[model samples]
Target chain A: MCCESDQPSLTQAGHRRGQIQLLAALSAIVLVWCGLLPALGRTTVLRQRIAFLEARGVNPSAKFFTEQEAGWRNAAEVERQLQEHPQAFWALPWRHR
Target chain B: MSQQSRQVSDDSLAMIAAGLMLAVSLCCTALGSTGGGGAAEAAASAWQNPLSALLKLPKSWESNPFAEVSGWLPGVVGSQLLLGAALVVGMLICRVRTGEFLLPFLKVFLLSVLAYVLAEQKVVKYYGLEYALWALLIGLLISNTVGLSGRLRPAVRTELYMKTGLVLLGAEVLFGKLLALGLPGICVSWVVTPVVLIVTFWFGQRVLKIESAALNMVISADMSVCGVSAAIATAAACRAKKEELTAAVGISLAFTVLMMVVMPPLIQLMGLGPVVGGAWVGGTIDSTGAVGAAGAMLGAEAEKVAVTIKMIQNMLIGVVAFGVAVYWVTYVERTEGTRPDISEIWRRFPRFILGFLGASVLISLLYENLSDGAGFVKAVVDGGTKTMRSWCFCLAFVSIGLETDLRTLSRFLRGGKPLVLYVCGQALNLLLSLLMSLLMFEVVFPEAADVLRK
Candidate 1:
């Protein structure tokens, strides 16, 4: 009779353990999604900057520090652009600057 | 198989796989197809998909939408998943039980993915907050807050990730590039750096009386060599406690930020031209990112000089890692009575340094022999292996955070000796780098500076 009574409780415990495992997996997935927030925001900014550069007739691909019109000379200039429109500045490749 | 044997077997397999990947990449680079344009386009396109943009999914996903859709991406995330799966298979092959490892490995993957995304954020990127720092911070937050569950234990393989990353980093260190700055560049980076490293380490040991010699070495290397990367290499070689590595890294990063912002303006005020300023900033700054950012502030000439000097200094990573490994095996862990045999030293030596050296030499040979091989090397190694290396480093930092207790770090900070060591080392580094830069670039090798200016 004792063994018979323990069966239902044992099943319940097993079910609970499964639930915790599932919850842990779900928690991890959620954390991953939330972490993407910053990258998503940055990407959006990069896209806008590319579009702005295209409109300005500036070849974003030109050798960095070579062209006088579009080329950035120093970090101060880059910082100024970033301050004004961060997406554009960050969108430019490291070599392009 | 026993757990110890299983671990050894798994590590050996990882080493082989890493070697194979490097060999194949080098061959691909030699075939006149480094895939630079394609890779860059793929990288730029990666920012298009919201999920990938946020997650920084592998470049493989850009070519195959199915991979992204199925969530089986192949670059950084894929490589880590594959590594985990391979370990599981290795266990199965060895006839070991693997039931407990699955959930913990999954947890590690999730955390690493999250850390990668955080690192990709604009503000973080602007500030040069690397994935390593973010991974460590996030892991610390999770462990200290919710606490690491029992299931997470299997996944926190910090040392494994670090060793693997170091091996991959070896491929990126091309000795040929050291000649770009010529002899003057060598003097500033090679000559002064070791002098500062030895002197600072001695100061820490004799004067500061720092308790952990490993910690002192790590700080000295980080300050005198290449910042965070140097700290990681030296700490691994000397078998530093996780908390000690953390303390050293924290100090380095904090000062890196301050120096990056403050140094450029100070250089301007000191009436240093772009060439001199660039060389000084590049040689002295703790972090490479900071070096570039600081040099960029001065102008393009400064930026060029800065990168060249930093590249020369980066060549020292292999030398420093090997030297530390040898020092540790010979002096620190010496078995008092008997002469240390070759076999014993080989056993005690960090095998990853061999992998690092092998990768460096192979790539250097390619750069020497092949036409436009530098481009190929940059394309294949930078685009492929370097990305994976970043992930490995991020994962390692995450593991460090998960394994560390806040109290453990706080206890190490009690006397603040490590802090003093870093500050003194950096101060000496600054004074020496300035003197050396002026002597080499301005006084001795002004022609090299002029060439860089043009």
Candidate 2:
């Protein structure tokens, strides 16, 4: 009589274990899908804000410095100086007035 | 059949398999060599033969006595070829003495060093792939049949090599770089790591029902956090089973290779600026070398962001390793009725990591003191350190391959849980990294974005 009573409980425990395994597998799948896929279609609004700050003279953290930034600064400074005085460089070295 | 007869059959079969694999490895090497036809042929013709290269040595009389000794000593020796030979010799000795074939760790290190040198010299364009593939081939042959039949020792050796390599790698991490991304980078790494780890682990256990907790943890960490290096570090700390390590590595390598090839194109297609793209790639990709490559391909800005982000993430490895070790000891081992003493913890702990920390501290101190002189010193140190780390890792990988049999790995797949866990965790890493990069880099650091655009 006792053995007969325990059979259902034993089967239920086994079922619960199987369910836990299934849930773990599903969570893993969900996590991967979330990580790899892009969150939205286009650049987030935050990216645009960053671009705006970058256009100004302010520097980002030193770690984030890209070679392109150096190039841009160099070119922009040259163009600005040229615009400031459309005349003569032969007689004197160029400097920002 | 009698037990004696079965044992004999197994041994004979193992020998036959080993012989076949060795032949295959040799064939692959020959084919690879021949494939490089023109340049290889030209170089071969112009240079002295391999024998001459072996025979030629720097004149001992030309250098200071100290320098000569330094040059002669195997520990300080710089020659990749010599290192390879030493590794082979070491493995052979171990095999003879123990009656077990262990994967030749030293040989892999040598080959990796060779690859790095070749790449630095522009002799080969893809150093990581070349070395990884080579190590894989050689490692596969040895581990599968010929090497040590016993499991525990090889696993221990591999862990030792990895930890030591990590410690040496510490010197290369500049504290200044860590401060570069400043608080944002730190926050991202700190926040993202636990979330990913917890979620992945939960999935591995509750959902996937992976029987081995160690394997589950490794896969979760590898995919959600840093990849093979992270996996190895964590696995060693936890004293994970050999099968678990193999699975983690397999997953990491597969994803890393795919990401390396696909990421640059994806960035371009999305029209994301270099900075955003690079940060995303760095955060998502498994391998540091692959991250750098992908970043470089994208643009200069991309390279900077990718490398910076990756380095920041890499720095977290030490902390993660420590945590894993603690967890294993305090929670897992303790629950199992094994009260681990502090000494046992120290014994199980990968000591070489201390070396890595020491190297980092030393380098940082030198940099602070030298300032202007730091550049030249950094270059030399960087070159040497990178060479060493690459070699060590390659050796470890080769050892792994040598010990592993494809059949064994396939048998592991019967559970089908690891594959699911890997894919899920990696996917999560990719998305989380992208979200964080977009928000932190794009929104928070607009100046960086503008600079990248220009």
Candidate 3:
């Protein structure tokens, strides 16, 4: 008889579960960013590793092939173009000059 | 309409969007461009293989548009409009609900920004971690935890965003640069990479008997080629699942951090001179920046050689993607004994690959012809497209993460074939690259080593 009664208890289960999951997910992110990452960053191993890379002039942060190589020269070239060409693709309204 | 027919149309429409974007970029690039020395710079940088020639990036994040937001507001607005047309068009055309797409687009844009900021953070960037992983983590967090509501579901168009990103990636594949390093660089990168990739894949399929062919291919390409970029291009070409791509990228990044740190010191200990050491590092390391950084540890010469060889290897992204697309259509999906019909192959083929190739060919032609074409092309790529591609990819990863079931990834990991395949493939790449670098630099054409000094 208890099982037979459609008391909407089962109907609300999905929503209740979703809410709980959301809270857990949020807590995980907060813990990682606020607690875990800060703690990890403060470690000697990570700091020394970062220092090692810096000394070698290696950019460990580069996600793609063209990224490190695509620096400085591009900006210089663009500045040159804006100075030379009356109308350049990059010659928009925003220039430091 | 059948799902198959719908997919064919979907791919075709993506190509159209890419084509439209390319056409607009060419118009902008073609209109006002006149200078010399850019090609001279190109010629010199060819052997050095300056990637700045291929793609544009800010000097640093601090000076880039993101940092100096107000100062560069107009330029930012213009570039975004110019390059983001394909992304916006992609979503709009997929299923027209002009009003509906806006919120979803905003959601995706915000997510991408968040991922980008997280990746760009000093500590994260310094550790060799990247935006794609952050985006994926964020996505997985949302999906496995709170989950996507109906309103958010519309923006999780992984294929569309990924396809557009692939096309942008294609534009950067300047095949003409492959010969810049001569035969030795070609041998180290082109010959060794494909051989290692093929052997690794066969080993996975025949020896290990991995269940998922797509997973095998992603790991192989990511190991052989340039990490996440190769994984992405391959995943799109073969239409691998989100979980498969996520796994492929995760493995690639983990290995890359290990390889980048260990390779330089190992190379130095081995007494492989800058040319050979740099070539070996360039040929082996998964990520581009790490290659440069690793190469620099040897010397300035080694750094140049390393970056140049990697740039040459980077061209393989297009060829391998196209080849994989063809192979998948022809053999992988074939049922038992029957040959795939031409029309069937056409239907099954990933047409976005065609967009990818088209962008490559178009941009290469422009770079070749104009007096100041190199400058003009550089302007186009550097000004906006790279950022757009990065954003699109970040969005795709986020979408993938949202859709993923963590259990599936854990299940795949349980097999352990992927780890074996990566180890074996990387081992082969190391052996062959070392042999080729030594042979080309020391034995056959010793003079090729001199080019590095020049």
Candidate 4:
């Protein structure tokens, strides 16, 4: 039953076509890497935005918590600040004014 | 192909994967100590932002693509080889013919690698399209168009890969970090997130009348919680189809890119300040990276607030997964008028979550109590297990794509109800999250905000 011959004609056709499609997909990846990706990176908008963010010491593309070093640094700093100012939790909102 | 035979096969597969999970976790933990005291202290301090962690990030490819690829390619290949070996052993234990499976597994791994490399492209990463999506797309294109051979069917083991990856991910979800934000962070994440999740889920179930409850739940969790990770966790808990997870990830990530780009500007225009703006972005944005990106744009204070809140929220996956599992056992999967036994729930519960939770506990303890543990564990994770996890998930998505039929998957989304549910849920999340962030960071705990601005 596990043999390919046991598969119906339609199923067999799908397997054959899938092989070809897989090749096409691989080709597309190559095209994108070689062409589309570099082109997009060079675009004015993305380049400018990334430059601006980098200048500000922000990583605009950081997707996960671990990816952002500034984040953990800031977390430690926040903890320290809170420790020094325990009353901040109850500090009057108007005090900021 | 009898039910009994399938059950036995599943048990064998799980037992083997369990061994693999333990091996990976232990190795990741042990690898932390390899850096010696000086390196560990340096990394530990760096985690406190006092320097080199960024140098080791996966983005190192930008500076020296070949060198970076050569550096990581070996580790990824080695880990995947371990996974492959384990599966082969499992197959042998099950008395399945080894020859039939090997070639298919190789094909899938190679294809998944291709997809992973493609997703790593700077433009794709910038657009926030993760490797999972690319893997699924490539597989889907092949399966739906050319169609796959029946011979390749033996290797599409999505569940195994997901379970293993989840265990690895568990190591990353250190519970100790949850305290970093204190009460203000808690109010914003714990209070607003679940409210938004439950309400959104209820809206999907009751109002939208979504046909597939699993789809509704996954989309709800993905939008409300931390995007792909939440969706993956919930989907596994509820045993949602891979196609549903794929769709949920697609919808959430697409919107994540838009929101990540748009929110910082919008916040500046509104003059919400970094605390509120960071909180808003953290709570509302689906992806952690996007949240950080958005927060960084607001300024360092906002980035910290945004990320810390999001990281705290990330911890909720443990509770959420357990809750969903319990709910599913007690209510969703119960037969009409029959009380569920403890044994039934135990059997039905997703065991991978236990692995996830266990890994989290193990790492959290190590991070908190062990001397220089933070640096060591971070080393192991950043160096070893993290890359392995990326490989695991990429393979899982590829397998999912291979196994799913596009026509059937489209049927799940026919009514556009999922899209409506996501948009509406996100709308609620944005509104509620904004209010809570204001109340917590402004009115109730404005002092916390003041400290953050420093």
In order, what lDDT does every prediction score? 0.66, 0.52, 0.70, 0.73
Better of 2 and 4 by lDDT: 4
Cα RMSD (angstroms) for every candidate in the order listed? 11.3, 17.9, 10.0, 4.8
For candidate 2, the per-residue lDDT at B401 reads 60
Residue-by-residue lDDT tens digits, candidate 3, B162-183 = 8877887777777676655656
Model 2: per-residue lDDT, tens digit, B1-454?
A: 4533332332233222222222232233333333322454444221111221221212212112234443333432443443334334434533423233234333344434433222221111222333444455445543333343244333324443454455545655555545445444554566776788889898888988888788888888777566766876777667675556777777776777688778899989989878779878878777665666667678666776676666667666766777877777666666466687887766444444454455566566755664232332233332244434445555555555645566665655676789888888878877887788787656665544454444
TM-score of each: 0.75, 0.59, 0.82, 0.87
Cα error of candidate 4 at position B337, Å: 2.0
Residue B285 of candidate 1: its Cα lDDT?
86
Write candidate 1's Cα lDDT for B1-454 as tens digits. Answer: 5543543554454455456556545554445443444455444221111122222342211112233444434344555654565556545664656788777877787788766665544444445566677788877766555556667877777766777677878887777656555566778899889999999999999999888888899999989998888888888777787878888888888888788779999999999989889989978987776676667668777876775677667778889989988988777778777678788787767666787888888778875675545455555554456655666677788988877778777877788888888888888888999998898767665655565665
Off by over 4 Å in 4: A1-28, A51-64, A67-71, A86-97, B1-68, B86-100
> What count of clashes does model 2 give?
28
Ranking by TM-score: 4, 3, 1, 2
DockQ of 1: 0.04
Give me the TM-scores for chain A across all models, comma-separated: 0.28, 0.26, 0.46, 0.61
**Best model per DockQ:** 4
Candidate 4 lDDT over B1-454, as tens digits, reads 6633553454456445545644654554454334435554554333221012221223422222354675556555566566677777877887877787777888898888767666666666666677778788877876776666677877777776776677777778888877667777778898989998999999988998898788889999999989988888888778887778988988998899999889999999998998889989999999887787788778877887888888888888888888987898788889999979998887776766777887788778978886666665565565555655666778888888877677767767787999999999999999999999888887788768887787
**Backbone clashes in model 1, listed as residue pairs:** none
Candidate 3: regions farther than 4 A off: A1-59, A70-97, B32-97
In model 2 chain B, where is the ten-residue run with the lowest total lDDT?
B54-63
